[model samples]
Target: MEYFGPNGDMYLATKKLKRIAIVLKPQESPAEFEIHFKRPDADEIMIKTEKDAELPHNAAIFHSAKTLVESVRVNDNPKKKRLVEDYTHINDQISTNETAIQDTLAYVNLTADIDKAGTTEHLNQIKELTVSINKEKRRRDSVLAAMIAHDWVGKREELDDLLQSDIQIQTPSTSHEQLMAMYDKLKQKGDQVAVLQSKLQNQLSWVSAEDTSRDDTFQELEKLADQLKDELDVLSVLENQRQSVCVGFLRSNKGVHKMLVELL
Candidate 1:
């Protein structure tokens, strides 16, 4: 399961398009959280620089869209880039060796807590990790009691000394080679993101050769419609007159087929 810390951050983009919000539970799919950032009466002037060069018509809207896409994408900032690399490395290690290092890591984390317990950040971590340490201690006592064929409480001090020694011996050795391997993966991911961003910016920057005039096109269409309506009206009247004249000729006394042709 994924989790978020209590910290919530947000940014405003003057040069951007649409924003949306989704459930704040699983996805960071844009939602409002409580404000940690109240505007103070400080003298620091924040000038806008993400604005694009003045372009014509729809280009301005496209520029805003470009800004929006870039703004939403993280890992572009140097600090965030480093943080992402560290997160990836940590998760990979934990997932791979979770079973193998459970007891040793528990012991190590407990000792680390002892050293860092003064800080508020470390204090929270220590509280949670202490549960793992207790579990390890209970497991150790059980196994030792079985092996010794007696109550583990009898030599509690000696048993703890031995356990500590074992945990120390099995401590993690994050060698240089392992670091380089992780770095290679991070580099590959960074390169892929760069390529994708380039493609997006290029696609968004496209402009038309000439400005289209919708008003002119609509006016022309209206003119043609009126002309067609007039022609249709004239055709309707002529057909009605022809029908009346044929009916009059049909009842002729002069055997009036020829008279009809020369009719008054």
Candidate 2:
């Protein structure tokens, strides 16, 4: 007699009346079976077999099914695990970059304040402050580059714009009085910028240290980006204010030059 096992493999047994049992495992008892046969033709017979086949058959079927099921489960889980690990690593990188950016911003703002205050002092102090501001600006640029590499598009753009405006403000011109006035306003702006930058740095440090998930880092970065944008707007206003003052000073100086020329 031939029978299909749970594994879908075929097994054959002799039709003798001797003991025939199917033992699935060495620790389990062999299930007994009663076989009835009726000769249908000269060379063919119909055989019906009975036993406690349901329990063993189900167990064998479950075992076979478990192999395939476990295999599929094992194959599927690793991709999810890898994805989770990748996400975690990316989050940690972002947090680290955010902290660096904030630190740079704080230093930039502090230097800007010093630039403003020092500009109101003697010529030597102003020159020293300019050098300090340039150094801080370069450091800030490096941080902006890192932020860009980390996919912080908005902040990178904002910092770039601020640096450009600072360069324009620092350009040499002959309107000492106008420069002084703009310098005063710049000092106030610098103080505000410094405070904001410091606050952002503190927040970023706190978030990086305490946050386990990337979501918090993302949120904090977004907030910092927005604040930076607003500060850039203020810088634009400062630029416009300085240009107006400088133009007025130039016009007055031109008038004085024309008066002297006519007098001569």
Candidate 3:
């Protein structure tokens, strides 16, 4: 008879009790046994035996093999535990990254509607959020590359799906036309203010030079200077208002541009 060891090594036994007992002896034996047994083929025969007869030798060999097998099983347990922990960590990271991306997209969408109503502070906030979004995208990409390298087949599919489903924010184009329009309006207001200022200065200079020589001329010049001063004040106010509008337009445009560049 032949039995397989835990390590897959095979040992032979004979029907003759002496040979069967001798072959099962432990390695540290002194005296040995030799027994003969009939072979499966009628014409053939063989003899085998172990060297030691200290105890039930076959039982000892069987138990030794069992111990080796058990040791291997024990060794694999920790490896399995580590694999589970690693998988859980990867899953959590992916979930967090996906949520961050979604939130960033939402913020981008909300900011898209900000036109004349968007304050400089609001635009600044959007810029900050976009910066965070880009950082998260980089992190997510790094995780995806790692997953691919590790052959994480299930995670690869899930990440691919998330990327595909992600909302892409388009970059806003530079508003050349809008800027030009605001510039034109401001230039016109500035020209009006300059004209009014010049007229006031000319009238005041006339009054100062003619005050002693001609009372009537000096009085007329004073009245003209006062009227010009009033027009200058009005024009200054209009210019300031136009400048404020221009500032708002520029700020909104900057925010839009920043959002676009991040998307690209």
Name the regions of candidate 2 deviating beyond 4 angstroms.
1-182, 207-214, 255-264
In terms of TM-score, the best-performing candidate is 2
Query: Candidate 3 — which residues are off by over 4 angstroms?
Result: 1-182, 199-213, 254-264
Model 2: per-residue Cα lDDT over 1-264, one tens digit each: 644322343333345633223324223322321122222222432222333333444344334333322332111335433433443344445445555555655655667656765434444443554565555444433332232233223454553454456654543454433445564675567566656665555555444322334554445555654665577578669857765544343244544323323322
Ranking by lDDT: 2, 3, 1
The sequence of per-residue lDDT tens digits that candidate 3 reaches over residues 1-264 is 744221243454444442321233354222221222223332322223332322244334333333332332211235433433443454455456556656656665677666434544555665665676566544533432332223233454553343345425332343323433543554465465455445545544443331233445544544544554455466556545533433333244544323323333
- lDDT per residue as tens, model 1, 1-264: 221122442233222222211123232222222232222332221221212112233344444445544643424557435534554454454444444345545656667756654345544555566655555444433322232222133655664454455543533343323434544554555455455555545544443213233334333333433443444455445434433332332232223323322322
For each predicted model, how many residue pairs clash, with residues at least 3 apart or on different chains? Answer: 0, 0, 5
Please state the error at residue 222 of candidate 1 in Å.
28
Native RMSD of candidate 1 (Å): 43.2
Q: How many times do residue backbones clash in model 1?
A: 0
* Steric clash count of candidate 3: 5
In model 1, which residue pairs have backbone atoms overlapping below 3 Å? none
As a whole number from 0 to 100, the lDDT of residue 133 in candidate 2 is 51
Model 1 regions more than 4 Å off: 1-60, 66-73, 101-197, 208-210, 213-264
Evaluated against the true structure, the overall lDDT of model 1 is 0.39
Give the Cα lDDT of each candidate: 0.39, 0.43, 0.41
